[model samples]
Target: MNKTISIIGSGFSALSASCYLAKAGHKVSIYEKNDAVGGRARQLIKDGFTFDIGPSWYWMPDVFEKFFNDFGKSTSDYYQLDKLSPAYKIFFSDDVITIGDHMDQICEEFERIEKGSSKPLRAFIARAQEHYDIAINKVVLKPGISPFELVTKETVTRIDRFFKTISTEVRKKFKNPKLISTLEFPVLFLGAKPSQTPSFYSFMNFADFGLGTWHPKGGMYEIIKAMKTLALSLGV
Candidate 1:
C-alpha cells in the first residue's frame, strides 16, 4: 500500500524528502506558504538582471551529485557545474587575494603571502580531509533521535575536537592573520563565531579548499530547481 506524504516547507530539505518519499511507493505533495517555492533559495527576477536572493555559494558538489545519483539522474542532466578557478577572493585594506581552485596554486599563493606557510596549510588540509570524509560519509547518516547515534568509534577517538574551537585550532596551526581569517570565514556558516564554533566543524575548510567551490551556471537556485524537477518526475 502507498502512503500519502505531505511536506510542509518547499525548501531544499522538503523537496528532497518529497522526491525520496514519492519514489518509495508513496504519494507526495508539497505545501509551501509562499507564492513561490524554494523558500530562502528562491530567485527574484527584475529589471533584466536576475537575482538569487539567497545562497550564492554551492559547497559540497559531491553531496549534490549524490542527491541526483540516488534519483537515477546526474546533476549534468539538470544543469552544468563549472568549478570556480579562484574559489573565492578576499579583499583587504591594501590588497586582494584570490584562493585558487587547484591545491598547487593555492599552496603557491600561501607561500608567496607568508613564508613557509604552504607546508602547514598542506598538513592542515590533509587532517581536514579526514574529518570531511568521516563527517560526510559516516556521521551525516546518523538519526538525530538518539544520542547514541553520535557514539561511533570515529567520534569517540575525535572527542577532543568537539571541545576545541576552529579559531583555536587554526591559530595554533597557522600564524598569518589573513590565512586564519580566511579559514575562519567558512565556519561562519554555523551561525556562530569561529572562536565559538567547534573544531569538528573545520571540515568546512575541506569543503572549501579540499573539495573546491563551484557554481551551477544559473545560480545556487538551480539545486532547488533540480530537486523540484526530481520530485515531479517521481510523481510527487
Candidate 2:
C-alpha cells in the first residue's frame, strides 16, 4: 500500500531511508532544519575555498557501492572517487606517524615505531578483518528489533570482544605509547574513549588499513548530493 511519509531530517541515513521507502511505492518527504540537505555531511564555502563540514574520509567503499547498486546505478555515475595514498598523518609533540593506504605500508610504518611490531599489527588486523566480515556482512544486516538479533554462531564465539575495550586490547599487544595511541585512534570516530569502546569495534582498523581511504572529486558532500539526487529520482 502506498502511504505518505514525512522524515524529520535529510541526513545520509534519513535520505537513504526516504529513497528506499519511496522506491517501495510510498510518498516520502524530507524536512531539514538547516538550509541544506546534507545534514552533518554538509559543505562550507568561504571566499573561493570549499570545505566539507563533516566526515571527510571515505572508507568502506563496498558499502557505498552496495547502496548505489540498489538503485541500478554506480558511484561513478554520480561522482569520481580517488583513493588517498599516505591516507593521513598523526602529529605528536616530537614525532609524526603516517598511515599508509594499504596494510603493507601501514605495517612498515608500525615497524619504524617499534621493532617487531608489524608482526603483531598483522595479527591484530587479521582478527579485525574477521570482525569486519561479521559486523558488516552479518550483524549490520539484522533489523535490530531484538537483542537476540546479535546472537549467532559467529558472534557467540567472539563474545569476549564485546566485554573487552579497545584500549585493553591495544595495550595488551603494543608497549609504546605512540603505537598504542595510533592503534586506538580509529575507535575515536565512534565518539567514545578507547577505554570505553568495545574491542569489537577494532573492525574500524580493518576499515582503515584494509579498505583504504578515498575521496570524491569535489568533497564528501558529493556523496550527500548523490544520495539526494537518487532520493529525488525515486520520487522522495
Candidate 3:
C-alpha cells in the first residue's frame, strides 16, 4: 500500500529511509532546514578540491550492500569501491603503526608486537562481530520507542556485553599500552571518549582492521551524487 511519508531531514539516514520508503511505494517528501540536501554528509568545495564534510569513510560495506540489495541493486551498480591499502595509519605517542590490508596480516602484526596477544585479539574481534550482527539485524534497525523496546530476554542477556566501556574492555584484553591506544583511537570518532562509548563499538575495529577501508572512485561526494540519483530514480 502506498502511504504518504514526510521525512524531516536530508542526512544519509533520512535520504536512505526516503529511498527505501519510496521503493516500497510510499509517497515520500523530505523537508530540510538547510537549503541543500545531504545534511551532515554535505559537500564542501575549495581550491578545486571537494570534501564530504562528514562520514568520509565507507567502513561497513556489508551494511551498504544489504541496503542496496533491498532495492534489487548492489553497491557496485551505484559506485565502485577500492579497498584502502595499509587500511589507515595509527599514531601512538612517538610510534606509528600502519594497519595492513588483510586480516591475517593485521593479526600477525598484533601478535608480533605483543606476544600471546593474538588469541585475545581474535576473541575480541569475534565478540565485536557478534555485536555488529545483533545491532544491525535486531537493534539498530528498529525504532527504539522506549527502554522496554530493548528489554527482551535475549537482549537482557546480551546487554552486559555492551555495558562496559570500550577502554575498560580493551585494557582488559591487551597489555601493551600502544596497541590498546591504537585500537581505541577510532572509538573517539564515534563522538564520545572510549570510556563513554559502549564496548560494542569495538566492532569498528573489527570493520577497520578486519574488513578494511574503502573509497568511492571519484570522491566521497560521489556518494551524495549516487544517493541523489537513487532518490530521484525512486520518484524523489
What's the number of clashes in each of the models? Answer: 0, 0, 0
Kindly report which residue pairs in candidate 1 clash with one another.
Answer: none
- Measured over all alpha carbons after superposition, the RMSD of each candidate to the real structure, in angstroms, is 1.3, 1.1, 2.3
Write model 2 residue lDDT over 47-66, tens digit each, in one string. Answer: 99999999987999999999
What order do you get sorting by TM-score, best first? Answer: 2, 1, 3
Kindly list the per-residue Cα lDDT of model 1 for residues 8-64, writing each as its tens digit: 989998998888888789998999988888999999989998889888888899988
Candidate 3 stretches with Cα past 4 Å from truth are 1-3, 32-36
In order of appearance, the predictions have TM-scores of 0.96, 0.96, 0.88
Return the TM-score for candidate 2, rounded to 2 decimals.
Answer: 0.96
**Worst lDDT window (10 residues) for model 1?**
141-150
